[model samples]
Target chain A: MTDPNKPASVARRTISTPLILTAILIALALIALASGSRPFNQTVIDIFLRVILVVGLYIFIGNSGVMSFGHIGFTCLGGYAAAWLTMPPMMKQTLLPGLPNWLMQLQLPYWAGALIAALWAALWAAVFGKILLRLSGIAASIATFAMLAMINTIYSNWESVTAATSSVVGIPIVRTIWPYLIAAILSVFIAWAHAISRAGLALRAARDEPTAAAASGVDITKERLIAFVISGAVMGMGGALFAHSIGVVTPDTFYLTLTFTSLSMLVVGGIGSLSGAVLGVVILSSLIQALRWLEAGVTVGSTTFGIPNGLQEITLGIVMIVILAFRPSGIMANSELIWPRARPEKPDEMSGTTPTQQGVTK
Target chain B: MQTLFDALSLGSLYALGALGIALIFGVMRLVNFAHGDVISFSVFALLWPSTDAVALVFAGDLPWFLLIPFVLLMGAGLSVLCELIIFRRFRGANPATMMIASFALGFVIRYFLLMLFSSRPKSISLLPALSQPVEILGARIPLLQVITIVATIAILFALTAFLKRTRFGLEMRAAAENFTMARMLGVRANRVIMGAFALSGALAAAIGLILASQTGTADIQMGGAVMLMAFIATVIGGLGSLPGAVLAGFLLGAASVVMQTLLPIDARPFRDAFVYGAVILVLIFRPQGLIAAPGTKERV
Candidate 1:
């Protein structure tokens, strides 16, 4: 019934999607390794963090058809947890005296702290998702945003514990790129695995056709909550790594700007596809780095010229708008990157055009 | 008594902001995140382009009559321009896409302002006469507070009359209720949306003027807090319901003032956390909001 040149089957994609993404990531890591420039290495690490965060975002938002403005709140929790666990006991004694005696005395390896941070964020996600997953559409989005604002307010004002708005220093920074690279790869695998799981299928079913899926005995709320908790864990891990990537953590760092950045990246990458999430970060991060270089001054012959100080952000905003205007579903339009040689004439079946592009506003 | 006045004045500001946001959401499902940026832009319109600590008051020096309309017109003009340039292309796009686009637009506006007038907060005396205290009944209130409350009520009354008595208002209300149906019934979609933008922008301008007068400073970030609170109000009131939004805005203001007055000193700093917690609880309990407008319910 199918042509020889048709898109690969679901089985082929199951193995191939992650493989292709992993190869791309490895290629990026290899390039960073070859370059050996400190700033460029740092930039790659930043991109890796975004990869983890955006992929984490895709786990819930991609499958559920719900936009959450609060996942970065998990990143905040994970970052603070990393700070509390990894900061030197002597520094904790002076800066965060309000922490419990055991917590104050505890100093953790970055890996252990990251693991605990994941669980910590997961626990809170479960709690919030239980209450929030019942709402649908825009109201749900607002509730999640409220959750983020609450976390921000509490963290910003909890001076004795969080040092208020002041940055908490002494988070052991990991300058090596391996840990972040591994974490980014791990997040992508987790996302791919979840996408193939039964719950993920059910959640996606609910997203595309809520009435039919509900009629077929899908517990929409439970499936959504499951995705919520898993994504929360991924976000938590990303947050801890984010703290380690920088030697300091502040509540402000995880607030609106980061929220919009990750969301924009995910949305721009193609909110519905896993490959889109990974590639979105890579492409946008590279563009941003290039813009920064240009901002610093690009040398052409003997002349050096640079953009205005704030034009990077302005231009980025314009670029995002143009991208969205031209392709509302994003650059990938919700389809993964398959083998170019075996391109499907009818498009890939599993993650074809998302339900969003089909004109289902709700 | 002073507490009540404070609550009312604050409530009036939120009400105006909610009204502005509600107007646009009613026409299109878009939640116009740039409304706050427009507020900031309107205030900055009064100042010359400079990054200095001292604000070079330009249009701000005009008589109060001209100054007020000038700021309002700036807000309206900017808002309409955004609708034409950016949002017009996004007609019938998914809500998430539109929301992100609006946010991106706001980012561009905020950064543009940052380029023109650095991140530093600039202080300017706006309508200095409004600073005087007037004794009303037993409590002395700032004249501006009384004016704010009265002006809000007048605006509400006029808006109600327009919506009820005029052809344009009727068309707008119909579009808000159901855009497709209204269009089929001969209402022009772009016209209604543009009108909504203009009115929303003017309300943002009004809030800008009031905020500038109250704070005596124009900071790039000044509109952010008010915008967030007003956004919450718009949702709490119900997305498409005008009266509901105004009512919810006033209620939110009262709750905020009451909490600030009643919370213990140590817990005062966490007031926003408590407020946000209450918001979460409200959404959980009334996902349809306190007042659900007709036709907004999803079809099963």
Candidate 2:
């Protein structure tokens, strides 16, 4: 619910920044749509889609300063939702012979199907977040972690519904630079808008100082629930975008490794701010891509000193450790990486608590 | 009949692991989420081949004497190492960071073990006496089950004494209850926390070895399943309460067994599911946990 008292100053502030950003994003999207499988174009699309995930993570993680080891679960939920919904009905029938009669009857187009999948992800999160969002710290984490494990096991074995959930082969190849590009821009928009929204402010308040937020009459539970659900829903949309792009979906893609990848992005990029999320995704995604290029690129002379793809994991792990040890606040900290001229303000009540308050302590 | 008994033994082992996790979370208030992997490291310490004659003196087909001490020592050492390295640094961070760290560290240790021990589950041999069945109430229960039950009782007794009787344990309790006050009173805070971590690690390792010996396989991923059980147990019992974890562990174990009994053959896959469901049920109704510290937190 939008606050009845919409601080009037926010409206008069500026349309130029939002318009300029939207314009730049549209141009980039057009370029992506025009380019067909160009190497750099692929990279550009990939970077933005990942930003969607970082931004999704930033919603709760940045505001709350809590670390979640299970955001990959949300991403996985999203990917599976999109892939399953968008499949050709005939292929869906053949692949999921055991799919219930109702699902077999419905055949939707890619975009509509993606929307449905995102809704499903949001719905699942709404159900789970009711229980999850109330508890702070480790209890919340453990509950969420349990959720991840249970879902993983269920999906791993619930083959009939998930096309052998372990593997979903033969997805219709509809992914392109455009979808990823759109998702990236949309993701940033949603993320930026959310941080300034009432729920976002309340969630941030609870995160910064639960005691103060609660004392000041912010419904911490409601704020967290909203953030948790929205975050999951956006990640789901990103996953749908990713599935359409990749043309295939597998449980392996959603394992602890991917979880580590996205998390490393959040950590290295910084967890407290939107710009950090964007920078983390762009920098880390490019780092991995550059490493891949290096591996495939020729040696300077006779001897090669190229790093192996497997070593990327080592690099990522090392980066997380270094970031935690040194600049855990992130380069942008809580600030956005690309800034608009003017900024937003908060309601009368915001807490001074650090990540320690909102974080999963156990 | 013996399989029925084996479940109880397994339950005891689960209880021990839960106790370990519960203790650390209770005291330092961090999840000690790497607990399962820490147990795995200790299991490797035991299963690691040793050529010395003294190694045989403890387990060389000699009987149960060496095995118990060896397991305990391995557990203690691994626990101490975890404290000094990963855990000690994350003391002041929020529960979220510590937990994320634990989850990450667990993976790191698991992968490292995968490199060393191969992900394959390995087993060790024990005495015929331990393996052989003992007839009880028309059901043949394995002697190992009896041993586990006895040992669990013994360990609990010793643990209670250590925590309730000894000054160090009191200091540890004080630190857990009120850190600043304890520190103001001249209690060495770091030393006590380190002790708690070491003890937690030791307990987890011992249980890990027992699990491997019973289940006939030691795998890098083994700790996670059990760790989840421990987490469930700790939550069911109470977040920072030891007795709660123990009670929850036994309840979870028994419930799983009974649940399997009630499950239709096809639904058995969801026995663990039901266990997790139970945890969720408990958590929703009682957020402070089954037996939270009196007056610690009261939600408005």
Candidate 3:
């Protein structure tokens, strides 16, 4: 068992995991840049944005062992916040006439808009988390999902403010990949920092051994709230970047499709480990890109053949099911990817208690 | 009178859906997110696969008696296939894993439908006779609405009697209460589970048929909104309580209809927001649900 009191070794291992993961991300970005294809660069940017979202998911889900379906609501909030702040004044006036005079008049830089978006998302997380974190297990999961539905419903129908289901465009488009790459790296570091923090360790301890942790005076709800707020902020930043990347924000975009995609990536990678979060994104995003290329058409000598449209999603679903059926704990299981020499002596200790064991014991 | 009838009719759909979800969750602790896709798949099974704008009706054109059973069988068949191929392997997996697997299964089913029919909603008129309005106690309502409410009540009673009096139903209830214990006592685990899946799938089909006939359209996503409401109903009712699931489903349906009628036209579109907000508040007050079942409580 990994002891929270053993800070020295835990801290050392934590630093290495984030460093190795960040290096891999940087290497992939460099390769994508070297490819010299605009579409490929866009794909790389998408992968980075996904990285931030999945890693943000990891901070709460991996540590707290709670499956939250509402975090994407924060992304919805963040995306709209970015769009509200960054869209030109004239466009905002016509598209979102419900905006107050100051917001209607103001247009901020991307970074500033993302900052406000993050804060806005975190604010809601704190409020919702206070009420939601009290419920544990399936109840908590359902509550979070309800929260998402509420957010989506409001955004989808509040016509003047959110443009009600229609896409709100005219935000500046960001084609460059560097900003996304940096944001992803920053998200990874933040997740790593949270994982090694007192609250994260307490939350994990509570997750793995709730009765014992509670006996030892761990406030499970408080730790969960902390993780929730931090993850909400990270998800918010990713959402803001997503708005800039696509040059449009819509309620449905942040609804079920995005929620499930980010979640599937996180779970397929390994829900319990940060390395799994990052690797899951890289592998799955690459698979999707490759599939899309085939769907567009693949050349064999002179003749061209293309996979039928919509086969990509079907294939992706099958792949995910196959993976989960075989490796229930996910590809990385619970262990972080580190240099072989840096791996701990006891493998089980590094991975902590597998979720299955915890499940059975509970 | 009109509002009361509308609420009952809408409630019938949700109640059926909640029952399907609750049954599976009781036995396996798995929240089958694919239940929605099962609904969609059953509806699409009525039409031949085509990219054309107009749906080519196949089984949908059958007489009402045959049509109902055909759709139910399709739902049961697909659901059973899913159990054999996918869910059976996840028997001992954690809840999160099982949930995600089911979700992936739903995704595959949904995309399969999308690929076949394209995303466009297909219009199909089924049981045109039932669409005509009938006066009942000074209120005018469609005959199909009356049938829906009556069918729901009949099914609920039949299910109740089956569980109370039949051997297989007894075994199912036993397994649901305590699967390992029931298994040790010689209940065939696989049989019981497969039966639950079959029943749940049939329920999904029933909902699909009603929705397809009432809306006069065979949209790929027709089942999604109802499924969501049903899932929430299952949660608010009690994880493993059948009666509670039914009751909560009705309550949710009534809540939705009431919101639709009472809210001003400007606020009508935001009705779902209020309903979901109420869901959060209910969860806060009753985390274990309104009627807690024996095995659902968390010790720690």
Error at A57, model 3, angstroms: 1.1
- Which candidate number maximizes TM-score? 3
Write candidate 2's Cα lDDT for A135-239 as tens digits. Answer: 766566667766776666666666677764556765666645666666677777676666656677667777666777778778887887788888888888877
Task: Supply candidate 1's per-residue lDDT for A204.
Answer: 82
Model 1 stretches astray by more than 4 angstroms: A1-12, A341-362
lDDT (CA) per prediction: 0.90, 0.68, 0.90
Candidate 1 global CA lDDT score: 0.90
Docking class of 3: high
Clashes of 3: 0
In candidate 2, which residue ranges exceed 4 Å CA deviation?
A: A1-50, A64-74, A105-107, A131-134, A211-217, A250-264, A283-300, A304-315, A328-332, A338-362, B1-7, B47-64, B120-129, B294-300
Model 1 misses residue B172 by how many Å? 0.2
| Candidate 3, A58-155: lDDT as tens digits | 99999999999999999999999999999999999899999999999999999999999999999999999999999988889989999999999999
TM per prediction: 0.96, 0.83, 0.97
Between which residue pairs do clashes occur in model 3? none
* Best first by DockQ, ranked: 3, 1, 2
